[model samples]
Structure formats: C-alpha cells, structure tokens
Target chain A: MKLTTTKRLERLNERYANGDISRRSFLTLTAAAAAATGLSMPWMGRALAAVSEVRFDGWGGVVQEAIDKYAFQPYTAKSKVKVVQGTFGDENEIITKIKTSKPGDFQIVHSSGVNYYIKYVNGGFNSEINEANIPNMANVLTAMIEPFRKITPKLSAVPYDYGTTGIAYNNKVISPEEAKEKGANLLTDTKYAGKIGGYADMTTRVWYAALQTKQDPNSIQDMDAVWAKVRETRDLAKKFWSSGAELMDLLSRNEIVVTDAWSGRVAALQQQGQPIGYLDPAGSYAWMEDMLVLKGSPMAECEELINFMLDPATSIAVAEGQNYPPSLDPTKVKLTDKIAALPAFDPTGSMKSLTFADPLYWAKNEDAWTKQWDRVSKGA
Target chain B: MTKGWKLYDQRLAWILVAPVLLLLILLLLLPIAMMTVYTFFTFVTAGVESAVLTFDNWKEFLTDSYYHGFLWKTVRVGAITAVICAILGYFPAYFIWATTFRHKWLLLLLLIVPFWISFTIRTFSWIHILGEQGLINVVLIRLGVISEPLPMLYTEGAVIMGLLHFLLPYMILNVYVSLESIDRTLIAAARSMGCTSAQAFREVTLPLSMPGLGAGLLLCFVLAAGSYVTPQLLGGSRDALFGNLIYDTIMGQLNWPMGATLSIVLFVLLGAAAAAYSRYMGLSQIMKGLSA
Candidate 1:
C-alpha cells in the first residue's frame, strides 16, 4: 500500500520527537508537501485511515515500561513496520471489540495468564502462527510453550515471559524462619494481622484460597470450598490492592509486612534495594504472558516482532528489565548473579511444587467464583 | 414571538441544532440502542455470539438475591454520600453566599480549585492521608502517640470520604446559587414582622433554597450511586457497589449479555426514580431551582 497521509504524519511526528527535524521545517515542509500532494491533515489522522500500522495492546506499569524500553524502541528502530501502541490489556474492552471491530484492527496483544486464551481465543477469536518466521522459537523454553498449548490447544500466541504468585515479605520484618513457617499462609496468619496485603484478581486470589484450604490446587471446582478458606484470612488483611503498583507502594511504604505478589515483582524491588523476599509457599501459582496476533492482522510482521522479542539478547533484556524470566532458554543468554538468584529467572528450580493455574477451570467458572469472592469482598 | 422567525422553521432551526442532535444520536442513542440489543443476546467467551434471543440474562439478574443485595448496597452508599454532601456543603455555601466581603469570589474559587485536578488523582491522594503507614500514621508513629497504625484507608468510611470530597463541590455550587437567589427583602420583611433571625432563616431563606438542596441531593446520589472508582480505591472488599458488579461482570467474567442487562436495569431504575422525583417537584420547578 502507498504510504497514507496518516502514516507520513506519524513518521513526521516521531521524527520531531526524536529531534531529527526542526519544528519550523516540519511545519513548512508538511504544509507545502500536503498542498502539492493533495493530502490533508484532519481526516487522514484517524486510525482507521492508516494501513500497515501494527497496533499494540500491552500491559501497564513495569511491563509496559520495559516493553517500550527493551522491545518496541529497538524493534521500531530496526524494522520497516510502524507500530502504534494503544491503550490495551483491558480484557473486557478488547473482548467487546473482538466482535464489532474489523479484522486487522488490532495486530498484537500482550496479557498475562492463559485465561483469555481459553475464554476468548479458544472460543474462536484467534489466528495461527508460523514458527519459522519467529526463528527464535528454538530458544524458547518448552516449559513456557506448554502452558499456552495446554490452555488453547492451538495457542497462536508465543510465550514472552512468565512469573509466579507467592508471598512477598520484607525479610527485615518477617525473617526467613517465620516466612517458611507461615508459607503461603503468611498473609492469612493472624500473627501478621493488619500487616498483610491481598490482591483482588480472582485467578491469583482463588489459587491462594485453594492452597489455604488444603484443597488440591489443580482441581478448584467448588466455589464454596475456596471462599471458606478465603474467609478465614479475610480479617487478617490490611487492604486488598488493586494494581501491581499499589501493592508495591504498600510494601515500599512499610505498610504491609507480607503481601501476595508476583515473584518477579519482589525480584525487581530487591534489585532496587528494597530487601523484599519472595517465598514459594507450600503451594502457589505460576503464570505466563503471551503475545498474540489476531486472525487477519498483519501476521508476517507480528511474527517478526515476536521473533525479535524472542531474540536471545532482547529476551535477556526483557527478563532483566521486567524482572520476569524470559520464555527463551537461559543457555542462550547469561544472567547476572543477582538476577539469577531470583526464582522466576530460574523456573526449573524449586517451583516444581507450585501448581500452574487451571485456565480451563477458571474460564468456565469465572462468573461463579467472582460472585463467591464478592460475598466476602471486604476482607478487612 | 418574532414576526420574521417561525417557531418551527425546519430549515433554519435544524441547521443550527443539527450538530448537537446528531452528536446526541451517535454518542448516546446509538450506544444505548446497541446495548438494548445486546441485553437479549447470549454472550459466550472469546467475543463469540450465539445470536440466540434469550431473556436468561435478565431472568438470572432478577432472580438472584445476591445482585439485589448489591442494588441495596449501592442505594445505601448513595444515600449516605448525598446526605453527607448536603450537610457539609450547606455551611460552606451559605458562608460564601451570606458574606459581603470583597474576596467572596476568592472563597468560591478555592472551593472549585480541587475540581481542576483530575478526579482519580484526588481520590488517590486520600491514600497518603489515610493508609496505615501514610502521612497520618507516620506522623503519629514519630510522635509516639500510637503504637500501631490505624486502619483508615480501606474502609467504608474512606469510600464515603472520597465520594463526599468529590460530590461536595457540586452540592455547594447548587446550594450557593439558591442562597444567592433568595431575596434579602423577604428576610428583612420577616424580621420586621417580629420574627427572630432564626425564624427568618427558617421561614424565608430555607424554603427558597429547597430547590437547590433537592437538585444537589438528586445529583449527588446519582453520581455516587454509579461511582466505581472512589469505592474501589478507598473501600476494600466490603464496598463493591453496583458499578463494581457491572465492571466485574463485563471485564472479569467477560459476560457482556449479563453486563448489558445490569446496565439496562440500572438505567431504568435510576431513570424511573428521577422521573418520579421530577413529577413530584414539577420538572419546571426543579430546573428553575437548579438555575437559581
């Protein structure tokens, strides 16, 4: 396709931001150029008018920041394809659009866990991937790919990174022995009352609840059974955090002694000298985030982007930057001592005991479980 | 009344009003129309639709006592917020209106300055003042006045506090307009009739300002009822109001049909109540009161 007016302007704007062109020159040239070329501004600026622009729907906070820094910036610098990052990771918003929006509207999506894969993509809103285009697939850990394949059966998504839900405690406050004793129950124990933090996400919280109740984490069909254990620890919580940033803020302020957190987050904080400790507990959850290219989207380009993400150096940068272990094989990229010490960076270690979330179960019973949790929403 | 201009001149009037009407149709009417259709359809995961016309979504919502409890909880939250906003707003709005000081506009400006900042940011600001190891707790701890941090942030009280902070400005503005609209002559006349200051306020000023108070009550309650942010940010698990329920259903469960059903239900319930209220007050009277 010929370069649309929108694409030209976007490139021009990007050049301006990069200081490649002076403002006066850009204004003067674009004005003269538009008049000469019979191209206009207002109408062409709309997203629908642009073709070959890869739409990225990514995570918020650290994940987004890291992706921008380590992946998007470098990829855009090298690749011919123009990527326009839009507001994303809002599953509901995306789900609504899945039906109404035309094909190729969104080219790439990044979200954690396989729930969406089972619930949405498996249900039919998906596209196939050519692994050959993503040559770096050879470097991707088999463990990482297994979860996606297990959930969707035909997961068009490539595993980008993975992490686990565990007890993140301040080593200075709780000490190693106390944390080991409390294990997954550290956040629920009365001894840590008013100092424990909880997350509101049903997937992680339900898994935590399952473990707390001594139920088989793999089979969490009974909503009542889950809520029963959740209720036992409800009063022990200081607050239910809404975001990763909020939970991190709670810890940074010395507000929470122990909180349910992603091991990757704790590792990130520790590197920043926060003295955060992550314990696997007797039972916990491991989750992975994937990059999906929708059917009728610019697949070849997206496959290239995923390949770039899976590249050995890019993968290592993402692992270090986001503090989540890359799905790529560790042998391909060397890790610093501090990063290697993070359990998420070495998934094959003690994480065998932790149960990976049952995505199929969650996809089926999300509504019922949501109501059950709503019954005890205020764990205060 | 003008000789040249016809009251229902289609060409001229429509030309002028077309933009607004078109905007309303596209932005408001279109979405509602779509939602009405979605309300009857079945939503499966993955954004797939069955095209099967069904009332199961509506039936499920109506039959479930769990959802009814959410409705009641939302009402309670709205009532509490509206009442508190009215009470708190009255003193300040009255103070501003009664004052003949040269800087009265400055006081009003100060009242509205907080609104200039983003509402979500304002809601988040409460966390520092109310969290366990936040400003208040840190101060108290340093002073050795408390051994443990108080649980001030994540409670029903904090949610109400946030709602009041946001809704109070509207309430004050409404009440201030009514108070300013009250004829000073009436109060003077009441005083001359052997009435005390309290009696003048009760008989003259209070009655005249009822419209503003009424408008404020309705506005605050409606806004607070639909608020999802303040409660989520401030109130822990205990305060998942109706908006929260809708959000979770749509986003978490990915159940659009049920979500649309809830939306329609909320819209109908609020609309019906507002209609009843307008009928009681007379729509003209309420509008006049708001303007006043």
Candidate 2:
C-alpha cells in the first residue's frame, strides 16, 4: 500500500509541475504529504491567482496607456488575474484619495514623484516589499533606486523612470554657450525679460535658484533674502507654467525663449528639428517616477507586477512610449537612431548630469518653498 | 372647503414638488453646509484634514493684504466687464428692435449664432488676435505702422476684451427681449402728447426697459466676478482673481480649509448683492434675464 501511494503522489506532482492542474488542486493532492513533510510556505501562489484583481491607480492618458500595454498586459497574460486601473495623480489629488480610502482598496499606484508623494508613505498607505518576489529589482540601474531609497523607508518604492529638470532654450534665441554661461541664473538675468517662462512649482525651480547665488539649496531654513533673488526671476517671467505640457506648448509657439523644463520634453522637440536644446543648469536635479505597492496589498502579486515592469524589454517599451529613461541599463534595450538621439531615453547617459534630489530633505522645506513662491516670488 | 380636505391637498402639492425640493437640498444646501464646516477645520500638509475647529483660515484671509488685493481686483474686473457689456450690447439690441428690415430675424441670428460655438474656444481665439505675433500685430508690423508687436495679451485690456466678448450676447438678448416686449403704441402716445422722438424714448422706452437692463447688469456682474479662466489665460502677471486664489489654495497648496473660507466669503458677498438686487427690483425680472 505505501509503494502504490508513493507512485500515485509522484505522478500527481509531475502533472502539477507540467502545468496540467491548478495550484489549489496540487496543494489538496499534497495535503497528506505536506502533513507528513511540512511544506506550507508564503511564496506559493493560489489556485488561479492570489487576488481576484489588482487595482492600479496611476496617472491617466498616454502614460497609463503605456503602462497597461507594456507592463499590465504582459503580467495579466501570465498571472491570469484581472487588472482594474484607476487614474490618480497631481500630488494633492493622489494624497487626498489615499487618505480617504480604506486600507488595501488600491493594490498599486504609479507614484510620480517620491519627494512630493512621500507623505503617503508616512501615512502608512505603503509599507512592505519582499526582495525575494522581485528578483529583477537588482537588474535595474542602482542610480534609479538609490536616491529614493535614501529619503524613503528602505524599499518602500522602486523607481521606474527618471529625467533631469533644467533649462530648455530656443537655440534660435539663446545660444548654447549663452545658456551654459548663465546656467540656472539665466532666469534672473533680465536679458530674457518678458521671455522667460517660470515653473509654477518651485521644488525644481528653487534648487536651481539657490544654487545660482551659491546658497546650500539642501539646507535652506528660512529664505529671508532668497525672496529678493527669486523676485528677480519672477519679474523677468511673463507667465508661470502649470505643467510640462503647457511649458512645451509655449516653447512650440515661440511664446517663450528660455524656461526651466524637463529634459525629455526638450529632447522630443529637438528631435523634431524645433531648434531647442536642454542644458543641465549647475548640475541638474534628477526627478524619478516610482511604483509603490500599497499597504495590505497582496504582496506576492504586487511584487510580481513591479518586477515585470523592471524587465529589460518592458522597461525599454515604457521608455520609448513615455519619453522617460529606461530604468534598466541603456544597452539592455536596442534603440533606433531616432530614440538614441534623445538624451533622456538612455539610462546611463541621463545619469551623467542628473543627481538624485533628497526627497526627505526636500519634504521638510516643500511647504516653505511653496509659501515663499506664492507670497514673495509672485508678489502676492 | 373643509380643513381636513385642505390639509390633504397641501400634502399632495408638496408630494408633486418633492423631487425639485430634494434636489435643491442635496445639490445646493448640502455642499454649502459642507463648505461651511470645512472653513472651521484645520488643513495640514499632504491633504490632511484635522477635526480640530479653528477660525485660523478665516482670520488669515481677513488679515492678509494679499487677499485684500485679489478681492479688490475681482470687484473692479467684474464691475468694468459688466458696464462694458451693457454699453456694447444695447446698441445692437436697439438696432435690431428699431429696424424695419425684412431680415430682422437674420440680424438676431447673426448675434446668437456665434454663441453656438464654445465660449472657451471663443476666448482662446482672442489669443491669436491679440498675441505678440498675432494677426493684428503681424499686419501692423508688415504695414510698418509700428516698429514692434504691441504688448496686446496678458494685460487688463485682454481680460476685459475676453469677458466683454462672452457676456455681450447675454446682455444683447436681455435688452432685446425688453425692447420687443414694450408696446410701440405707448411711445407713439408720448410723441403725440407734444414730445420729440428723444423725449418719447426717455419718458416711455428707457424707463420701461429698465427691468431687462437691470437683470443683464446683475447677471454679467455675478458671472464676471466668479470667472477664473479668463484672467488666467488672458490677464497679465498681476491679474490674479478671487477664483484663482481659491483654486490655488485648494489644488496647488492643498489647503482646503483656506479654499473653503475664500469660497464662502465670495459666496456670501455675491449672495448679499444678488439678494439686494432681488429686493430692489423684482426677483422675476432678474430671473427673466437668465432664462432669456
């Protein structure tokens, strides 16, 4: 009787290994062996899927479409779990949704900026990540993950893409040498008066402005005199841009000659022969977008999805579609001449001039920066 | 006839109107109540809403000179836009009414057809007309009438132009309805009673058309005061409106308490002005302009 049982169990195990049966049936079949051998484990998946669906609240429009096509679709094909997507972005709106929602309502979110969205981590909406589930996390570029890990709780989120925040200019109006000479201080130079475009949010803009006058941007406590310097730039600006898209529109129309903008946008326009060039003004600050698993999420599946997103092929597809630098090594994904020409599409190259912004440090002074920008820079 | 029967009829009447009453309570009163409650709460960083009640938001607005400047700017813009609309709208309306042309409907159609296109699109069109390298400036520069393109956009003049263009239709419609409704025979009677054409208009036509004129003024003022987009898109650097301030506090700064306070203050002031208008002129007259 014992010999027959061993042969029967071995055949059942072979069928399970060959993907003939669900994990649930395999567990039931192995219940007797498991009672004898103690094989219960955390890494094991359920019969069909761990969860019925994983809700992903991410930025809407083309970015979400790219994530769905390259990341969500591929994972869903393999895992057989449904993916329910919701749009959540624009820092305040995302914070409000997570704060109001019950724990684990959303399993994943494409967090745009860790510096701005770290409050959600502090609020405990996102907490744990298991390195074992995500074997591919190590394959991704360290520079992509290192800075965010420094500011956040260890391994709270993993980065997906990064870009430099610096000055973009119409080469027709300002020469490349001129932009380099002025660097970030070009905003207040007065030569570009009524032509400079200012960013509405000062996280990127303040860093540039502080570095101009030789103040430690990372250590500003009270910017008592910084306002006077900021005001110089504000006086030169015709209008402040609310988004990268809006700033890009102004550039396209020649409505603005010089502006602080994202590197990707300038690269895209330059590729189209728009006579645009992007400069890393005084060693540019790198802004990384990340994927954070929510607190109480199905750990195994969420980690699987994030790991899938970091796969070289998937990361490359996302980089091409979304105009972000692939988080993996530049050589992992072969780029066409058109894509190779764009600076931000290459991971190692983007890192050449881009430095990780200290979010934890920036988080402390973000509100002060906002207040000063509103009250003083805008001359409220 | 009987008291019990009368009570039953009253109950039936309320039952018939219950949907509208419920909608008003839900959509209007509930939101205002929630807004009022928010003004008392404290807003912290990262969109945190604290249950602790305080008047700090209101106190800040009342004390801040920055807010004062915005409030003052909103009122001035509203008043100026309304006055300009009323002035420009009356001439077209009067022309349509006075014309004996067979295609008077065609003339009125020309006035109202532009409104069929989106007002936002119409406002944006002003950009191409008024931008630095815009049509007018380009033409002027080619003609050598000016050395450089005029600073036509992002100014107070641009904002007024946008508001005036949008609100003109409303003003014209209201004034036309008032002019059309007036009995032509009354003016004839005034002229027969030893009055000139101008005198007849002053005595009979002008006084009689005051209801529509008043309604148009108040409606224009209310909408212009609460507008955010026109100033943001068209106005200069110093042209931030009250609505912009409220929006900035809520969306940009994530300070809901401050935003709610600004909204309530604006609502109460506008509500008071509307109420005064209703009391001085009849409510029916004001509503007629909106429906028109």
Candidate 3:
C-alpha cells in the first residue's frame, strides 16, 4: 500500500510513542521526508501540546494518597506532565460517569481488575496499549497480567496491586480465636446482630455469602442459598459501608463490631492500634486493582506514567504506604520487608494461595445478580 | 410606539420572557425530553443500552411491585415530614413574626445560617450525634440513664429526622413570610369587637396564614420526596426512597433505560403533586414565600 504523507507521519508518531524508534532517528527521518515532500507538518505542534495533562480517577483516601505521593508526584516532577485526579466511592459509579461523558473526558482509571476490565471492554471504552511502551511490565507478575489479557488480546490495563476483602473484627469485642473459628460465618453470626457491618458491594456480598453457604464463589451451584445468606447478614448488619474512609470511621468509632473490609484499610487500622483483627478466611475473596487507560487518552503519556508507577522503588513505596501487596514479581524484583509482611502478600509469586473470581463466570451473571443484590440489600 | 408597547401586549410580553423561556427549554425541558426518549430504548447490559425502540422499561415498571412499594414509602415519608415541619415550624415562625424584639431580621438571619454550610456535611453531622459512640448515647451512658446505646443512626426514624432538619427552614420561612404579610389592624379590629386574643388569631391571623402553610407543605413534600442524600447517609438500607432507587438503577446497575424510566416516573409524580397544589392554592403563594 502506498503511504500518504499523513499516514506516514502517523505511523512515525506511533512508533516514537511506543519507544520503537529513538527521538533523534524519528526527527532525522521526519526531516528527510519533509524535505523530500517539500512540505512542513502543521499538526505536529497540536498533537504534542494535546498530552500536557492526563486525567486519572481512583478510589480516594490512603490508597490514592500513596499513589499521588509516590507515583504521580515524582512522575510529574520528571515528565512535566500533570496527572489530574478524581475519586469514586464505587467502580460502578465511575462507569456511569464515563457513560454519560464524551470519550477522552476521562482518560485513566484505577480500575478494579478483570471483572471491571470486561465491563470497559464490553462498553467499547478500552484502549489497546503497545506493550513495548510500558517496559516495566517485565517485573509485574504474569499471573496478574494474564487475567486482563484473557479478556482482551491487546490489554487496556496493567495490574497494579492485590488485596483480600477479609473479615475485620474489633479485637476488643471478638477474639481473634473466635474470628478464625467462625471464619466467613462470623459475618452472619446472630451473636453480632445490629453491630455487624459489610462492604455495600455486590461482589463482596456475594463472595462472602458463597463462603457462608459452602459454595464456590467463582462457580456457585446454589445462588439461592448464597442470596439467602446475604439477606441473613443484611438483617444482622448495622450498616454496609461504601468507602474505605467510612469503613475506617465505622471500625474506629466502635459503631460496628465486624465487617468484610479491604485488607489494606484493616492493616492501617491495626497500625493505628484500633484493636482491629483481620482474618482472611479460607476461600476469602481476593481481588486485584489495575491502572486502566481508556480509549481516546494520550497513550504515550499514560504509558509513561504507568511505567513510572511500576518502577520497583516507586511500586514498593506505594505498596508499603497503601498496605496492599504490589503486583511486582518477588522473583524478578526485590521488595521491602514492609510490603512482604502486608496482607495477602504471596512471596513465592505463584499466586496459587489466593482465590480470585472467574471473570467470565461472574460477568455472565453480573446483570441479574447485581439487580437482585440491590433489592435484597434494601430489605427485599 | 406607545400603542405597540402597551404593558400587556403579547409581543412585548414574549420579548420580556424569551430569555428565561429559552433557558428553561435548554436546561429543563431538553434533559427531560432526552430522558423520555431514553426510556423507550433497549437495555443491552450494564452500560451498554441500545437505541432500538422498545417498551420493556415501561412494561417492567408498570408490572413491578418493588417500584410501587418504594414510591409509596417515599410519598408516605415525605408527607409525614412535611406535616411535622408545618406543626413544628409554625410556632417558631409565629414567635418571630409576633416578637416584641426590635431586631426581627436577626431571627430570620439565624434561620438562613444552616445553608451556609455544605448540605452533605450537615447531613453527615447527624452521624456523630446519633451513632453508638455519639454524643447522646455517650452522655446518656455517662449519666447512668441508659444501659446501652440506642440504635438511632441507621433507621427510618433517622431518615425522617434528617428530612425534618433540612425541610424545617423552608417551612419556617414560608410561614413567616405569610404571617408577615398579615394585616395587624385586622387582629386589633377583632379584639376591639370583644374577641379574645386566641379567638382573634383564629378568626384573622390563622385564616390569613393558611396559604403560606399550604405552600410550605407542598415545598417540603416535593423536596423531601425527591431527596437522595439524607436517606443514603442517615437511613438504613430499607429506608431507601424513590430517588435512591433511581440512583441505584442508574449509578449502581448502569441500567440507564430503566433508570430513565424510574426518573421520568418520579418527575411526573412530583410534577403532578405541584400541579395539584397550584390548581388548588395557586403557585403565587410559594413564590411570595420564597422571595421573602
């Protein structure tokens, strides 16, 4: 195919963005082509200027604080490109926002892993990332990236960190021994009625419910039993928190004795001497978070930012600060003792110890299950 | 020119109202029209609706008892809240209107103070006052008056309490403005005709203030019924209003077609209520209350 001047320039730009060609080589080639064609490119300046700011939305609180402090601040200092930040209490809330907005209005999201990745892909909001651009994916665990890759052959997101939605109990009220003994059933224990709490999310509610009903979350045979268990807990719960900050406040203030909580927030509470005990029950729900690049985003800048975030030192700092295990392969990259000791950390890097939701299995039932959960949660 | 520019001339009136009319069409009518169109679209999945025309959304809504139950509950709660506001609000408004104090404006200024703070923060403040470890519970526990903390924070009662806190000011203002517009000499005239103060108030003051009270009730009802935040923050899961239902459908379920259907249902329901009030009592009273 004969390449038009515009197509040639576009291909050259993509190559440069993907780090396939060096700047000097690209400039030399472009100058030669310009001289041969006897024309100057008018769109080059506008294209370069378009990527000055990259919009990012994430779950705000300590997690975003860590990212902003360790990754975004240093990346901004180095690249001179701003990372504008927004926050959402729920992933669905952000998806709704994106749906209402025009493309490019939201560029990058701190997306919940493969399950949400499927939603974005289904909604046609995903962008194909040139793996060549984000070189630091080498250090990331293949176990984490493979899930995202399964949904889209060309990945739109890079897995960043992992944690469990474990049971967090007020140690003053419930003994650690009792928490371990009861396991996931503690959430539905009548003894903690009117004092229990849980995450107000369908996946978390259903996952814990599956465990309580002695069914596999990824492939539940008895959804009726699972939902019954959810309603049982809902009856017992004092409140179902929607955000990490609310979770912390509920735990710290002694408003709730027990709840399924984010492992990192539980760790933060423990560090603060809040008498919080975290127990990742057998078959606890393990989930991963990813730095997702949306369609119409400035690809080069986003890839550069992800690369900066994945740098070992930066990633470790963020992991330590956020109290979640980084997605860095322990064998490939040396991690700090703090990150290794964090909740849900798999030192062997095989990721066999943690159980994750089957994205396809869950995605199939997401619409129906979510609607029912919303109803059951409201005293259906 | 004078003949053409008569005050009630249709062309002059249209020109005068055109900017606001255009703004109303752009901001209000256009969004509602779009939402109405969306209600007919097919919901493919979460965040993936199709424009293929279908009546599935409306059919589901019409057949569903769940939506009906929530709508009934919202209206019930809103009515209870408005009635409570009118009862609780009237006395304070009467006190302000009949006060012998020279600085009457100070009382009205105090009424406006709550609006200075963010509404969400104000709603959230109730948590600190009503939670298990909150002020009332802690104080009661310390005083040896209560053995355990009451479950005051997350209940239907808490939702009503929150609505009262938010809607009371509107009621007070409406009542106060109506009371202020009353002719004082009429009360004096009734008293001079051998009527007791109470009888005078019943004959003159109370009858005159009914419009304000009615307007306040309507305003409170509409605002409370459409509320989303107060219930989400202060009420239990079961205390979710119709607005919360619409929010979950749109924001949680990502079912925009159904969400829009729910939304249009609420819009029509609330619009019908305002229309009924206007048809009976006239909307001018509400305008007078709001302006004052």
Point to the candidate with the largest DockQ: 3
Query: DockQ of all candidates, in order?
Result: 0.41, 0.27, 0.82
Off by over 4 Å in 3: A1-46, B1-4
User: Order of candidates by lDDT, top first?
Assistant: 3, 1, 2
- Compare the candidates by lDDT and give the number of the best one: 3
Model 2: per-residue Cα lDDT over B146-168, one tens digit each: 98778878788899899998888
Q: Ten residues in a row with the worst lDDT in model 3 chain A?
A: A42-51
Estimate, for each residue in A1-380, the C-alpha lDDT of model 1 and write its tens digit: 79976688778755532334544565666776688788776523432232355788876678778887888889888985677886543555676666567766776788665776765564566676766667788877776677778765655888887778888998898898888887887867887887888777766678888887777677865657778767766777777776677778888888787988877767778878997888887666887788877755655567778889888777778777888877766665555564576565563533354466767666677666665675576432
Candidate 3: tens digits of C-alpha lDDT, residues A209-327:
99998998998999999999999999999999999999999999999999999999999999888899999999999999999988767777888899999999999999998999999
What value does the lDDT take at residue B239 in candidate 3? Answer: 93
Q: Which is the better candidate, 1 or 2, if ranked by DockQ?
A: 1
lDDT of 3 at A258: 95
| TM-scores of chain B, in order | 0.91, 0.94, 0.98
Write candidate 3's Cα lDDT for B17-85 as tens digits. 999999999999999999999999998889999999999999999998999999999999999999999
> What's model 1's TM-score?
0.86
